[model samples]
Target chain A: MHEHIQPVALEKAYRLLNHGPTVLVSSHHDGVDNVMAAAWACALDFAPPKLTVVLDKATKTRELIEKSGRFVIQVPTVKLLRLTHEVGTRSLANEPSKLQDTGVELLHLAGDTLPFVAGCSGWLECRLVPEPHNQATYDLFIGEVVAAWADDRVFYDGHWHFETAGREWGSIHHIAGGHFYAIGEQMSARPKRGG
Target chain B: MHEHIQPVALEKAYRLLNHGPTVLVSSHHDGVDNVMAAAWACALDFAPPKLTVVLDKATKTRELIEKSGRFVIQVPTVKLLRLTHEVGTRSLANEPSKLQDTGVELLHLAGDTLPFVAGCSGWLECRLVPEPHNQATYDLFIGEVVAAWADDRVFYDGHWHFETAGREWGSIHHIAGGHFYAIGEQMSARPKRGG
Candidate 1:
């Protein structure tokens, strides 16, 4: 694990994905480590944090997740924009060195066998909540987050510091084609007038 | 219907939500209408665009959706920040005047009774694709987008011009509490290196 990486409380894990950002999905199965970028992931629940990510049937990452029943969803930074696109469009099914060719590096967390993509500001280690119907029909898979971590510099004290952190640390949201939008200015809604 | 609002092709409707933004969900049933803010909405599929939103059982909007089997998911702008938070937190079940008190204005399109938040940048009218087990277990609802529209000034040519449009036109993404980050600078990934 990177020096700056720190564990985020399980209750606060949902905040990591609350703001919709493109994420890198990684999994390890049968000695195979695969990573892919997903734009359709969203936080599903807060307590005992859970999330949903749409994984196309064609991706090797999805296959790994199906076999292992575990995967990691990580928040890719603006700095990883091109890498994210490359991983999302290209495939390990055709290219044997998809991860290496796309400049993806994996970080292992001690005894955990799941592969975590490096350079992400936050990560949620998930256990697949099998839903055969949803998976086969919509390519939608649900995962219950068992552990979570984030870089102290970018996400500490229970919330994102994108406003104070370097721009490179900002999370990116894919628009269409190869275009994306890095999360922008912070705005706070006024507190209740009369509760 | 606002003159600036234009119909978005069904095939291209997914682009409206491709970049994850907190959405305002509105529904109508019997003689009642309701709207609520949701950060858990995500694009589920492309063709015949489908989406998933987690609606807590407590929300009046969810009840309206359950009875009507229809809803509208619209992208709330930075300008609707306070209104979004207010609608999400206040309940029509308790506060009968929630919508009016929160300054939420609605725009109806011809025959449709589903309330569309007036200032939203984009709107997707959906018909519920009922999945009983998922809804009962997860409070997750899936909808197939039957029609869509976007404000031309901000979203035209099938893409968002948030960078060039007024900052307030940008879609807002909730992080936690009432804090949010507006969709930021546009970044394009480098073109594919090779086939």
Candidate 2:
């Protein structure tokens, strides 16, 4: 059921991140893994979809992501608010691994390349685009998205249907102090170009 | 009336952007000025209040912002949807800049250093922190916010009061195709660390 959603076009993958939901950065390397929350990420480019996420130098996820040159970002729903806070606050270094620290279930990709949190609304597999200067100076890393997927029940046909019947998937955007604002009330504005 | 709002502590300023609203990047350089719509920006650091915004190399606003080394990000309200469309569509390259392209009432600081749209609920005045690698490779510009302000009616004492009486100043989050989701209900998640 999790794999039912088809891959999003690399170009359109930026849309999944367009609205700025807080994401859980997941990565694995050499049998070691890490996960952490990051609100400092945004679409860096459109085609060949690229994204920039800040990972502080002192994080276990940063070490794992840098070592493997790949990572996955997942948009968790409000239902995972407790888990989000749990995973975000604790360091993998303290517990030796995220898998042991929390009750969150993880699904490893074929060949055990990287891990993705189960029950996430959206997920993107990305390979690092090396930018050492930004990484060392700002703790920022750029990634070129190679694969993308989302729960079709929540996103499909290039649009998000949080209102779809029997579908209650809504992306979570963390504000401050463990507070989150769930995506709500979709409305469209006509393109002002044809005037 | 958009002039005065108590200064926000730099570290806490990220809270303002943590929710992820599309912002209007307003900048001026050598007497020329421009404003463009941007949904690709996020709070990067806490202390010293740093932010990262993706600016297309082709955008006139990017050129002006790069030259000025200063830009103000204004968080527009839902009431400015038409103005947002107008600003997003019209480029600064052609005659009549976004300031004039849209009928937005401009509010300028006394020093003329920072300017903001009158209807916006929050504003951040940032000084560029040059990261040439990210800029040349990814068109990402990093800025350290020096001063920040917010409309007391909507944001006071670091909490948004959109639920208050008389005025409802909801922030706009851009999804794609000029479509946006007005910021909806606020929900808080307690710290799982202590609880």
**Interface RMSD, every prediction, one decimal place:** 0.7, 1.2
lDDT of 1 by residue, B64-97 (tens): 9989999999999988998999998899999998
TM-score of chain B of each: 0.96, 0.90
Q: Where does candidate 1 stray beyond 4 Å?
A: A192-195, B192-195
Tens-digit lDDT track of model 1 for A1-195: 478999999999999999899999999999888899999999999888999999998999889999999999999999899999999999999998998898898998635788988899999999999999999999999999999999998999999999999899999999888999999998989665696
Cα lDDT tens digits for candidate 2, A1-195: 656656777777888888888899999889887788888888888878889899998799999988899999888876777788788888888787566767778876434658888777778899999878778877888898988887787778777777552323777778777877777676667854677
Clashes of each: 0, 0
Error of 1 at B115 (Å): 1.0
Any residue pairs clashing in model 1, and if so which?
none
Positional deviation of A12 in candidate 2, in angstroms?
0.6
Q: Judge candidate 1 at residue B158 and give its lDDT.
A: 90
Give DockQ for candidates 1 onward, in order. Answer: 0.88, 0.78
Model 2: per-residue Cα lDDT at residue A84: 81
